[model samples]
Target chain A: MTDSWLTSLITATPQEGFELAITLSRRGVKYTQPDPEVLHRLRPDYANSADSLTAASHVIAVNFQTVAAANNYWRT
Target chain B: MTDSWLTSLITATPQEGFELAITLSRRGVKYTQPDPEVLHRLRPDYANSADSLTAASHVIAVNFQTVAAANNYWRT
Candidate 1:
């Protein structure tokens, strides 16, 4: 849990930036729910739910926003 | 590009499934725009836009839905 996967958000490309955004979101979820068993148990309730999926996407987008800001929107 | 990062969508845990969903969404984008330069150029256009961010989120949600179905909603 202490291992750092994120060294920098300043990616050389948008693709990397987007990937970083996903990583950030995933890490956030892991931080919030460190217990894999509990997360697995709760998966059924939210997996098929459109609302939950949409919510997950929203979180990713927010992460993307943060990454974008960090990278200055990849502007030269 | 030939190296496969996706082994399975049937994760042992929901967290893993969610991460896979994010990967799927990211891969989709990469497929759509193989050129990093083009994607980077496009970043500024969508980076600060609420609609664009929301759109990205929606895409992730859709990918999540696919992963959920593939994993049978993680119902064991």
Candidate 2:
């Protein structure tokens, strides 16, 4: 948590930026939880549930919108 | 995949913006890998790897940088 991990988000392409977005989302969960045991234990509750998956998607869309805005919607 | 889930990234606060960033990351995964079974099957491989988890953080940092820049580093 103390280590410096980020370098830049000015990706060469939208595809890379999109992949980075996924990583950001997963990392966010890790940072918020920080405990693997708890995360694993709770996996079952959401892994098999469609609702949970959809909710996860919703969260991603929100973040994507933010990223899109940052990159000016990847205007070229 | 075509539900049009995003509304806006102009969050009321940075905390909300950060949360949105996480959501965007997760959603990106879903979009990239629509098959839940595949995602579930591959989960165990990285779930326990510290390197994978750290990498996730790096990704988050990258996306976060994008978000930070978008928000002007959340400057007042």
Model 1 stretches with alpha carbons more than 4 Å out: B1-76
TM-score of chain A of each: 0.80, 0.76
Best candidate according to DockQ? 2
The lDDT leader among the candidates is 1
Model 1 Cα lDDT, one tens digit per residue, B1-76: 5555644445777778688767766565554345677556566655677876677667767666655655667787
lDDT (CA) for every model shown? 0.63, 0.60
Instruction: Name the 10 consecutive residues with the lowest summed lDDT in model 2 chain B.
Output: B1-10
Task: Please give, for residues B1-76, the per-residue lDDT of candidate 2 as tens digits.
Answer: 5455544445566776677666555555566457788678756655676865565454455456555656666678
Put down candidate 2 lDDT per residue, A1-76, tens digits, no spaces.
Answer: 9876667666554455555565676778989999999988987666554445544554554555455665664544
The TM-score of candidate 1 is 0.48
Clashing pairs in 1: A57-B57
Quote the chain B TM-score of every prediction: 0.78, 0.73
